[model samples]
Target chain A: MIHFNDVTKIYNSNVKAIENMNFTVEEGELVIMLGPSGCGKTTLLRMVNQLESITKGDIMLNGKSVWHSNKIEMRRNIGYVIQSNGLFPNMNIEDNAMIVPNLLGWDRKKMRDRFNMLMELVGLNPDEYRKRYPHELSGGQQQRVGVARALAADPPVMLMDEPFGALDPIIRTHLQEEFLQIQKELKKTILFVSHDIDEAVKMADKIALLKGGKMMQYAEPARMLNKPANSFVAEFVGQDRVLKSMSLYTVRDLANALTLKPVIESPDSQNINENLSLRVAISKILNQEADQLIVENDNGTRKGSITLDLIEQFLHREIKESV
Target chain B: MCSGGDLIVNLIEYFVSNFTFILGYTWDHIKLVGLAIIIAIVIGVPLGIYCSVNKYAASTILQIASIMMTIPSLALFGIMIPVLSLINEGIGTLPAIIALVLYSQLPIIRNTYTAINNVDPDIRDAANGIGLTTFQRLIKVELPNAMPLIMAGIRTATVLNIGVGAIATLIGAGGLGGIIYQGILRTNNTMILAGAIAVAVLALIADLFLRLIENLFTPKGVKK
Candidate 1:
C-alpha cells in the first residue's frame, strides 16, 4: 500500500541521507527497514508520513503522493509510534491513547469504548490505567499504551520506528511477541524500522536491509539468510545465518518435511510443542543433554521424536530444496 | 527610645487606632500589584510563546527582557514618568502599573519561553507525528505541559511586583508606600514598620495564593 518512487534525501544540499530509494510495501505486509545506525532507515520511514522532507523524489501511499497530500489529514490516517513511547506526560492513559480519535472528533462515549478496546488489545487493563499518567506506568506498560495510542484511530498503515528499542531485553521480547499477535488480527500495513537483525527476522514479512542510505538487500527473512544479495548482505545477516534461519521453521515444519524418529519415551525426556521453532528445539537438546525430544500437539498427542541428527538433515533438505 | 515591651505595646496601639487607614492602603497596594500582574501576563505570555516559535526573535526578545529586569525599579518608575507623561498618564496608577508590568516581564517571559521550549522533544515529535496541527499542539500539548513552569514564572513576578509596588508612593501613586514615605518624612519608625510589614505580608500571601493556583492549573499527570 506504500510505494517509494526514486526517493532521495540530502541534508544541507550535500549530505545524502537517502539516495534514490525505491521500494513497495505491500498491503498487510510488515516490511522492516533494517540496518545499522545512519543507514537512513529512520529517515526513510519518516518520509512516508512526511515527517522528513524529500529532497528529490516522492512517496505514494495507496497511490496518493504523500508529498502532495494534505500533511495533517494524511498523518491522522497513518499511525506512528516511536522508540520513546512518547506518551504525553500531562495526560492520563485514556487521553494519551485516544489522542487521534479525539482529534477526529469522536464523541466521548465512542472514545471511551475505543480506549478500553485498544488497551485490551495491547494487553493493558483499561479501567485500572485510564486515570493513571505516563509517569505512573512501568516502561513496558507505557510502551503498550504507546502501541494502543497508535492504533487508537485504527489507521490503515502504521509507521513504527523501533517502538520496542527502549525496553529491556526481556520486556522487549514479550512486547514483540504480543505485537506480532496483534498484527495477525489487525493486518495493518506496517513499516517497522529496526537495527537488530533478530527482531527483523522474527517480526518482518519482508526485510529491507540497508547500508549507508542504500538498499543492501530486500527479501524474505529465510531467503535473505539463505541466499544473500551480496557479500555485505551475507555478512550483515551474520556468520550464523543458518542458525538464524533455523528460527523461521518450527518442529511441525520439520516433521512435515521428513520422517521423524519413533517416540522413545523416557522419564528424563521433555516433551515440547510441535509448533515451537527449531531454534528452541536446538537449545532444549543442548541444554538438557537429551538425545531427542518428544514433540506433541496442543492436545498432548505425540507427533514423534526429533533428534539433533534429524534436525540437521531437515535443514539440509530445506536448503537444497530452496536452492 | 522606650523599653522593648513598651515599644511593642505602642506599636499595637498605633495599629489599633489606624486599622482602617492601614486597610485602605493595603487594598490600594493589592489593586496596584494585581492590575500590573494581569497586564504583564496578557502581554508577556504571548510574547514568550512567540519567542519559542521564532528562533530569530527569541534572542532579541529575551535580551530585551533581561535588560528590563536589570534596570532598577526606581529608575524604571522614573523613566515611566517622562515616557507616560506624553500619553497624559504621567503619574499615579498608570505610571505605577507601567513600571510594575515592565519589571514583571523578565520572569514571566523567561519562564514561559523556557517552559515551552523545553517541553520534552520526544513528546513534541509524537504530537506532530500523530497529526496535531500547530495550534492544537500548542493548546493541547505544549501549553498544558508548560503550565507548571509558566505558573512558577508568574509566582515569581507576583512576589517581585508586590515588593516593588511599595516604591510607587515615590511617584505619588497611593499604596502602602505612601504610609512608609510619610513615616520616613516625619521620622516615625512605627509607621515605617507597619507599611514595611504590610508589604512583606502581602508578598507572602501573594506567593502562597499563586502556589495554590499553580497546583490547580498544573496537569495531574505531570505533578511530582
Candidate 2:
C-alpha cells in the first residue's frame, strides 16, 4: 500500500501546489487523481514515485519510507507512463520495452520473453511491431507500446500521467477498455492522473477529486456521484450524476442471479457482452423488442442475461440508497 | 575554335607535366586541412555539449565563436603569426594550423550546441520519467538524436578549413596554396586554375564523406 501523510508541495517562496494532502492507495487498487488543470493532482501522483519531491511530509510505500531506498532503484521498480509515450526514437519497440530491464542487467533471453508477453498483453502483435521505431507507429499504437514498455519489468506500482490524453475519442475509449482488461488481469497498484472525470469514473476503483490542491472528495465512483462532499464536487460532477453513475457500472455489476441465467427459450439476434457498459445494455434493451439481452464474458462463454425490469429495479435501489 | 582548342591543349599539357608537383602539394593540402579539422572536432564537440548544458557559459562561448567568425581570415592568420612567433612557431604550418583551428570553432561549436539543445524536451522527460540517469540519457538518447546536425557542422568546418588552408601557403605553409601563390606571383593562369580545381574537389570530397557518416548514423525513425 502507498500512504501519503500530510504531504505538501511548495514552489518558489511558498506557492502551495498541494497542501496538507493525505490519502492511502491500497495494493492492487487503481486510484484516479482527478481535478482541474492546476489542482496539483499530477504533483500528488508524481510524489508517490518521487518524480516530484515532497516539500513536506512523508510518503511511505509498503509501510517503509521511500527515502530509505536508493532513488534510481526505487524509480526502476515503479513503472511510469506519460501521454507523450516516451519510446526512444533510436530503438525499435522491442528495444524500447527492454530499456529498464536492460538497465537492471536482465539476461537477453528474459528481456526478449518479457517484450513478447507485454506486446500481447497491451494488444499489439509483437511480430509486426517489435522492429518498428516509435516514430513509425501511429499515435494510438505508440501509446499502446508505451503501456507495454512501462509494464515490461512487471513493477508492482505504476504511475500513468494522462496516458490517453493525446488520442482521438474513439481510440481513447478503445485504449481505456483494453487498459481496464489489462488492469483486471495484472492488478498493479496504479495512480492515474487525469482532468477528465469520465475517465476517472470509468477506470478508477476510487476517484480522488481535488480542488485547489486539497481533496474535495476521495471515494468510490458511485459514492462520489451519489454523495458529493460539497458544492464544488457536486458541480464538478455535474447535474447528470445519476446518468454518470450509470456509465461507471456495467451489465455484470447489476445483472445478478435475480435477472442473470443461462440463455433460455430463443436466441435473440443481438447479444450484449457481460463486460459492456450498462448504458449500452439500456440502449440494447430499449432498441430491441426483447425483454432481455444475452451477456457473454471475455472467454465468449454465455454466462448470463440482463432484462429491462432488472435495470429499472437496480436504478430504483440506487436512488433509494443515495437518498 | 582556335582559342578554345588552344586552351584545351594548354591545360592537358600543363596537367601531364606538373602531375607529380601537383600530387605532392595535394597531399600537403590534405594534411593541413585534415589535421586542423580533426583537432578542432576533438576540442569542439565537448565544448559544445558543455555550453548547451550551462546557460551562462553558452552565451560566453558563442560570443567568442561569433567574434572569431567575424574576423577576416587573413587578419586572423596575421594575429596568429605573432602569437605563435613567441614560441618560434612563426611562419609555416604551425601558425597556419592555429589559424585554421580558430576559424573552425564557430561552425563546429555552434552546430554541436544547437543540435544538442534542440533535442525534444519530451524525450528527456520520458527518459527521466522511465528512470534513466542523466548521464545515460545524454549518451544514449541526446547524442544519437544530435548526430545528424553535428555531422553537418563538421562537414562545414572541413570545407571551410580546406579553403583557409590554401591561403596559409602565403605564410610558407606549403600546400596547393604554394601553386596558387606562385601562379599569382608569376602570372601563370594554368597553375592558378589547377590549384583552384583541386581545392574545390577536396572540399567536395570532405563534404561527401561526412554526409555518408551522417546518413549512416541518423536513426531511421527520425529520417523524413
Candidate 3:
C-alpha cells in the first residue's frame, strides 16, 4: 500500500509542480495518475520513488515513511519504469535486467535464475534477447526490457511513467494487454502515469485525473467516464466519454444486464464474448441477420437476450448523458 | 659498390658500440612520456569533472588554459626559464616535464568535461531513480560512459607529449632528441634520421596501444 498526505512539490523558484495532494492505493491495485501534459501527474508518480522530493508532506509505502527509509533500499524494493525505457546503453539486456540484483549482491546463480525468469515474464526469450544490446531492439521490445529490468528484483510496488507512450498504436495495445496479464499474476501495487485518456481507462483500476497541479477526480474508470467531476476532466477526457466508457463495460456488463428469458443463437455468436464492448454489441444487432444477441454468463451459460432496441436505447442514452 | 659496403659496415659498428647508450636513452624517453601522461590525467580529469559540475569555475579555468595554449611552446619555455630558475638554476628535465604537462592538459580537461556533461539526461535520471549514490553513479555509469572520449583525449595528449618532449634536448634535458641535436651540430644526416624515425615510431606505437585499450573497454553500443 502507498499513501500520500498533503504532498507538494515546488521547483527551483516556487513554480508548483504539485500542490497539497493526498491519495492512497491498496495492495494489488493499479492506480493511474491521468492528466494533461505538465499537469503534475508525472511529478506525483515520481514522488513514489522519491525521484522528485516532496516539499510539504509525507509519503508512506507499506506503512513506513519513504523519507525516513534508506533511499537505496527503498528504491530496490520498488520497481520503476520511465517513458524512455531507461535501460543502460552500456549493458546487454541480460545485464540490464540483473542490475538491481547485482546491487543487492546476489550470488551468480540467483542472478542468472532471476534474469531468465524475468525475460520470459516480459515475453522476451532468454537465449535470443539476453545478449543483445538495447539499440538492437525495437522501441516496444526495449520498453519490455525496461519493464523486465524493474521487475527482476521482484519488488512489491511498481511505478511506471508512460511506459507505452513511445510505441506505435498497435504495439502499444499489445503491450498494454501483456502488462495487464502480468499485473494480474504479479499482484504488485502499481502507479502508472499517462496523458492518454483511453489508455487510462483501459489500464487503470482507479484513475486520478489531475489538472494544473491539482487532482480533479480519483475514482474507478467507469465512474470517471460516466460522470467526470468537473468541466476540466470532461474536456480533458475529450468528446468520447461514451466510447471511452465502452472500455469499462465488458461483455460481462452487458450479459449481467440481460433478462435471460429467451435464448437466441446466431452464426457470428462467437464474435461477442464476455469482453466485447457495447458498441460492438450495437454493431452485431444492426447487422440484423439474427433477431436477438446472445449474452453468456461467466460460467458460459446462455444467460439471456439483448434486443436491438435495448442496445440502441443504451447508446442513445449514453450519448445524451455525455453531451 | 665497395664504398657503399664500407659505409654500411661502419654504420653497423657504430650502432654496436653505442648499443647500451641508445637503448637506455630510448627507455628514458619512453619513461618521460609515460610519466607526463599519467600526471596530466591525474590532474586534468578530476579538474574537468569539477569544472563541468560548477559553471563559473569551468569558464575561468578554460579561459586561462586556452590563453596558455595560444602561447608558442618555445617562448613559453623561454619565459619559464627565469621563473623556474628561481626554484632550480640548472635547466633540466623538470622544466621540460612541466612544459609538456601544460601542453597535455587542455584536451584531457575539455574532453572529460564534455563527455560527462553530454551523457543523456534520461540515463542519468534513470541512474538516480535506480538509487545509485552520486559516487556510485560517477564511478560506474558516468565514468564508463564518458571513457571513450576521455581516452581519445588522453591519446592526443600522449602523442603530443612525446613530440614536445623531444624538443627538451635543446635545454640540456637528455633523451633520444640529444642524438638529433648532436647530429645537427656535426651535420650528420644519418643520426638525425635515426632520432626522427625513433620518435615517430614511439608516437605511432603509443597511439596503437591506446586504441587497443579503448576498443577493449568501449561498450558495444557506443562503438561507432
lDDT of 3 by residue, A1-323 (tens): 99989998989967999989999999999999988788998888888888878898999999999889998889889998999988888888888888888888999999988888888988989989988988899999999999998898889999999999999999999999999999989999999998888888888989999988998999887778778888888888888786678666666665555434366555644334556676666656677655666776557776666776666566565545544
DockQ each: 0.89, 0.66, 0.66
Query: For candidate 3, lDDT tens digit of each residue in B2-70?
Result: 476765665566568877877777787888778878898999999889987898999888877778778
Order candidates by lDDT, high to low.
1, 2, 3
lDDT of 2: 0.86
Q: What is the TM-score of chain A in candidate 1?
A: 0.97
Q: Considering every candidate listed, which one attains the maximal lDDT?
A: 1
Q: Give per-residue CA lDDT, model 2, range A148-192, as digits (tens).
A: 888988999999999999999999999999999999999999999
Best by TM-score: 1
Q: How well is candidate 3 docked (DockQ)?
A: 0.66
RMSD of 1: 1.4
- What are the models' TM-scores? 0.97, 0.92, 0.89
Model 1 / residue A199 / CA error / Å: 1.2
Candidate 1 per-residue C-alpha lDDT over B104-124 given as tens digits, one digit per residue, 9 for 90 to 100: 999999999999999999999
Query: How many angstroms is residue A168 displaced in model 3 relative to the true structure, after the best TM-score fit?
Result: 1.3
lDDT of 3 at B143: 82
- Which one is best on DockQ? 1
For model 1, residues A1-323, the per-residue Cα lDDT tens digits are 99999999999989999999999999999999998899999999999998899998889999999867999999999999999998999999999999999999999999999998998999989899999999999999999999999999999999999999999999999999999999999999999999899999999999999999999988999999988889999999999999999999999999998888998878757788999999989988988767779989999999889988999999888877766
